[model samples]
Target: MILTREAITTAVEHGDIVIEPFAPERVSPNAYDWHLGDRIRVCEGDELDAAAATRVSEHVIPAEGMVLRPGRLYLGVTHERTHSERYAQMINGDRSLGALGIWVHVSAPLGHVGHAIRWTLEIRAAQPVKVYPLMPFGKIVFLSTAGATASYQHLGHKYTRTSGIDISRLYEELR
Candidate 1:
């Protein structure tokens, strides 16, 4: 089941989800909108395409963010880490970022732990910095649709949970 705004609020209130310097208004019907931190790494067109086949060997983070003036912000999404089988698909969007007004995601897949996604925010000047895990994906999408789910318990009296979302079918729907 996709989480509702009430569920999101409850989770945050109960300490199940946490985003530093959080705002209640950011919570949406099914996800939370994350603000752009003062940092980002923008891959060139070729670099962005290359990631589809090979991950980048070099990550260039500006010493400070670019073009950022005071109090301006970028927006993005966050994923709930409750489910261990973390899967994320972030597509681009259109929003003004001073002059470089393209949208992007912050993600490191597979065996990433301790490592973080860094970004640079350029307004009047550039200042590169780091942001932590997001609570939701910028409230852009909750799910392509309500996710189907199922769970079971183990014989040892332990409650082991599971999911039943058929991703293959989900893909067809998205396309």
Candidate 2:
């Protein structure tokens, strides 16, 4: 079952959930609103190979904002760094952004337990859209787990304790 806002708050208080720089007002009915971080990354080249590591270029989103265009994949990170030992997490793009043709994540929005970090977002737009640093862009929902649980650390996950936007490490597995 998904956790309610009150349960999320209780989990935070109990140390089962952690959201850095937490603000109570950002709490929604079932999720917490997270903002866009200052930095973003875009992979270089026209064609991508699944078995080779791709090159990426990083840029800082100015306070004035940045424009995202269609036909390009931009990697972004959440302003908040969060983790939950007691619950799994999933992030979804805000409806406001969706209406503007912005997609915060493509396919991988599910976060594993004990993976503490600012989430890396797979961003794309159907049309040009202006997005600003620290703008509320997505909401993260927490869910209760059943049976035995193991931390992501024990599982040897690839994106461990990432500080900013992490590009695909899928090539590592293909090698």
Q: Report the number of the highest-lDDT candidate.
A: 2
**Per-residue lDDT of 1-175 in model 2, one digit per residue for the tens?**
8888898888888999999989988888899999999999987889878888878999999988999989988999999999987788999898999999998886998888887889999999999999999999999999888899998856877887678888888999998
lDDT for each residue of candidate 1 in 107-135, tens digit (9 for 90 to 100): 31211111112212221223442334331
| TM-score (C-alpha) between model 2 and the true structure | 0.97
lDDT of 2 at 146: 87
Reference-based lDDT, each prediction: 0.33, 0.89
- Highest TM-score: which candidate? 2
Evaluate model 2: give its lDDT. 0.89
- Badly placed stretches (over 4 Å) of model 2 are none
**Where is the poorest 10-residue window by lDDT in model 2?**
153-162
> What's the TM-score of every candidate structure?
0.36, 0.97
